[model samples]
Target: MLRESHKDRIQEEIGNDEIVTGKGLNQEISLVRAEDTRWNSHLKTITSLISLFPEVKKVLEYVEDDGDNGASRLQASGLLSYFKTFEFVFYMHLMLTILGLTNSLSQALQRKDQDILEAVDLIRTTKAQLQMLRENGFDQVLEKCYSFCDKHEIVKLDMTEALNPCNSFSQFNKSSLLKLSKMYPRDFDDKERMILEHELDIYYHFVYNDVRFANLNGIADLARSMVATRKHLSYPLVYRLLKLTLVLPVATATVERCFSAMKLVKTNLRNRIGDDFLNAALICDIEKEAHAKVKTEDVIDRFQKMKTRRGQI
Candidate 1:
């Protein structure tokens, strides 16, 4: 129901005295529709909804009371009732707060710079923020919800009981550490695995207490700190584990990119290509940076040297 005329009516109802001719509503705010593929779209939609709430209610009330179409009137009535409920308002504010917290991290990950270290640091920061919110943010959010309900004349539910937030952060326990070590059997034999267990116990305590490593943001930073302090020699197995963790994201992204490149390489027109040629094409396509560095003349000379030719160029 939020057409140009409807927006004009909303503006007039809200006492916005701006005058403009020929469909020029200078202060009109429109609702945003969310998309499935883009998560930030949901955040934008929520923000717009919150901003245009009074305008939306005015439009819906007009439609429900005096609209020309019966179906439109029924829809507007149902929506108006739903929008005034405590549950809807409460969840809307909750989602707004949560999405706002992670929006920066989401934008960082989508950047084209491929700075894995920064991305990892953002991941850690996001996790810590979420944990803190879970532990201590409920009362603050509830107070906001209460103020909103009071302003809007919505009924407030009694929130007398409080829930104990469960701790979800992963702890480096013995079993978990052993499971991680077993993933790379070649890197750690039986003797080294036992040593790694001991090293982990010491490493966790040391890092937590050490001033230099206290503020390290990412695994890469921790690795560098270990080397700079010559602690890598002190805990060789733990240092090795840090190195593995550092490359895990890069390795995962490379594998994902290779699979994505396959879709472009093995099209319907090229479906008949052999496995050997397909593999070579995918490798070149995925590693374009490395492929671009080689000289064309060198590739041509290498191809020519593979077999005797009747004519040489």
Candidate 2:
């Protein structure tokens, strides 16, 4: 309602003009109403809010002070109280900071150029950075939060007070975590050296002796090499592992794409098509390059060979 009422004014002020910042986001972008179905959308929503925080605060204040109805005014006041708080401001910055790190990692994982080793290294680096942040950067984050709160005119909380645990009743066993961390030895001591030797011997005995995998670069390379050489039968365990790394779709993106392609291929107009026909049509539509490679004459010959026909074109 607030947006609708002031749409004309907002348009007049912004006028399709974009305000570029660090993220290259435009100030003309309106505040997004988040939905549960699209959880990642909340990240974008938060970003937009942060970018337009000043303008948004002004609008919220206007609604609270000048709303036409009591209900609108009350709602606006509640929104202002909720938004302009130390907790909200802190959490907003916290999420933004964390998500910025994870977004890079996510993009790295999504890249075709990233192999398992690189991805694993990226994960370890990100994990270490997060641990470092938790251990040493809390004060810096706190200072930033304080700065944001001051800018927003929200009262700062007492920093000396003990921080509240997420679950007061839950017991966190720090000793157990320490013990678990020790399971993966950081230094190659006598015991660690023996463990590493045994593991390496077992691994090399199976995979290193295999000539076909001699030049395998990464998991992706292993999958392709094994399949190309038809050596999957020679090394069952290694083949299985490599196959999983290659064929297993991590993000449901491929499945979603297939479904979307199915919708286009098997629409209401072709709803009554047989299951086999639908599958074939979907395959052709989805695999456009492969379908393009196939000649029309070859398809005609294959159709004719399937069964006897009254006439052939």
Candidate 3:
């Protein structure tokens, strides 16, 4: 095979020396090949994993999947996977990029390959989008840096309180969006324009889901406020925490799976099980995956054999 087999050759290619730059990296990058646990945060780990599928960049490259408004483009499908792969890296770059780090920009600019540079710029654009939380006179400069709307639709908003979800999205309507778009200052920068536009678009979701999120969802409320000001918002701590927790249902499709499992187990043989027993049995039956490492084939097989013998009698 065309490969480096020796420990030395492989280590040489993946060595610490090749890590080159650690611009936004916090942890020390290490080389891990066979069984080293330290590879989790290494440069090789980051790049190799991102490199596994060139398809990621392709998703970002797609400008028009749906024939919708030309102004709105889809975020890269690879970008989400990139998110799963490198949240810390994304945030680190976000911080560096928003702060306008000379080094970070330089690394991106230094890439002679136009394609890579453009991709890096696209990634930077996403990471640098910023939303501010201003309630009345106070400005709580939000740290989750990101942009809002695109150019051409710049707008200004005159708001009172820091808009919460109830006051923001759920309450927003299409007419309000048009009004926000009208408020754009003539000489606004690209980012300002985008933020204002993003806020308006965000308002639509709130208008649709007001009933479901009337007062319960905390993060949703905060996002709704961003809609009020006509800027897309990102709450780093709260959003990440909620995302990880909510992902099981929203992202994983596990809720539908549980219902399916319930139907499967409650079929004719065990249809008479009471509500209490039915719920418990469903839980235990679906959670067999947790004991996957724990072998119990022999116990189950014996139980089945004994049940068959008794039935024979």
Candidate 4:
């Protein structure tokens, strides 16, 4: 509903006299769709919502009062109530903060030249930042939320009151913590430390220290360098492991795109297409650059040569 309202406003602005000629001030932007499996898309959607808050609020107000149906009015009222709160603002900022790092990491991991070594370093950096945020970001977020609420004239929640659990059952007693820890040995202490130490040992001595792996910057480079240097033959097991890692596809945006395309291509009307044909079609769809390089004349010639067919001038 908020996006729909913004769309109307954007269209109005685009049709307006003054702002239409401006480059940056124009209303060409649209809200991104947030897919549940794609965190970056969600981040983008949230970011867009934050940018269009005033317009969104106006739209919500209109819907709350002027909706055609009771259900819509109720839904809009609920959404407006939820949106105009310190908790929602704080959570929005918090998710945007966290997803920024994760989005970068996701993009980096999906790069064609992505290195496992570099990915490990990026993961460690992100983990450290998360730890810092966990320790100190709550108060900072609350302060920002307070300022936002003040600016928007929303009822500001008392921090102390907000911190209290709504129900006694929802609050964990001091004794419950002790009991939970006693019940679960896995939650006891220093397990994470031990795991980190062991992982660091493997990475430092095995993955990073090797001269072959150290020479190249990316996984693709590593593969090529290993082949050129004949290090694969020298360290067969390590090379095989590295090769496996390089070949192993990370189910990131590429896989999501493939599935999205598959849904369109394999609709009920086109269900008769064989798996092999579907695979070929998908390859052509996904690798459009490669597909575009093939000459149509060459394809026709090949088809003609495949069997004796109807006469062609």
TM-score of each: 0.45, 0.40, 0.20, 0.45
User: On residues 1-313, what C-alpha lDDT tens digit does candidate 1 reach at each position?
Assistant: 5556546665685575555545554466678898643457879999888867777888899999998999999999999998997667767887787778778886787789859988899889887777677766766677787888897788765332110011211233544455556656788899999888887778767766677765655455667888999999998987776665443211123544775688888888988999999999998998899999999999989989999999884
> How many times do residue backbones clash in model 3?
17
State the weakest 10-residue window (summed lDDT) of model 4.
160-169
> Which tens-of-lDDT digit does each residue in 38-66 have in candidate 3?
21223344444323323333333453354
Spell out the clash pairs found in candidate 1.
Answer: none
Query: Pairing residues by index, what is the TM-score of model 4?
Result: 0.45
Candidates in order have lDDT scores of: 0.71, 0.59, 0.40, 0.63
Q: Give the TM-score of candidate 2.
A: 0.40
- Cα lDDT of model 3 overall? 0.40
Better of 1 and 2 by lDDT: 1
Please provide the root mean square deviation of candidate 1 (C-alpha atoms, Å).
Answer: 15.9
Task: Kindly list the per-residue Cα lDDT of model 2 for residues 1-313, writing each as its tens digit.
Answer: 4354345545554665532234543224667886433334556788878757767777879988999999999998998887876657766876666656555665787679888998889888887767666556656666887887787688765332211112331222333222222322443345644453444345445444666656544455655665777766654443443332233112223444577687787778878989899889888877888899999999899999998899985
Question: Alpha-carbon error at 29 in model 3, in Å?
Answer: 12
- Give the worst 10-residue stretch by lDDT in candidate 2: 160-169
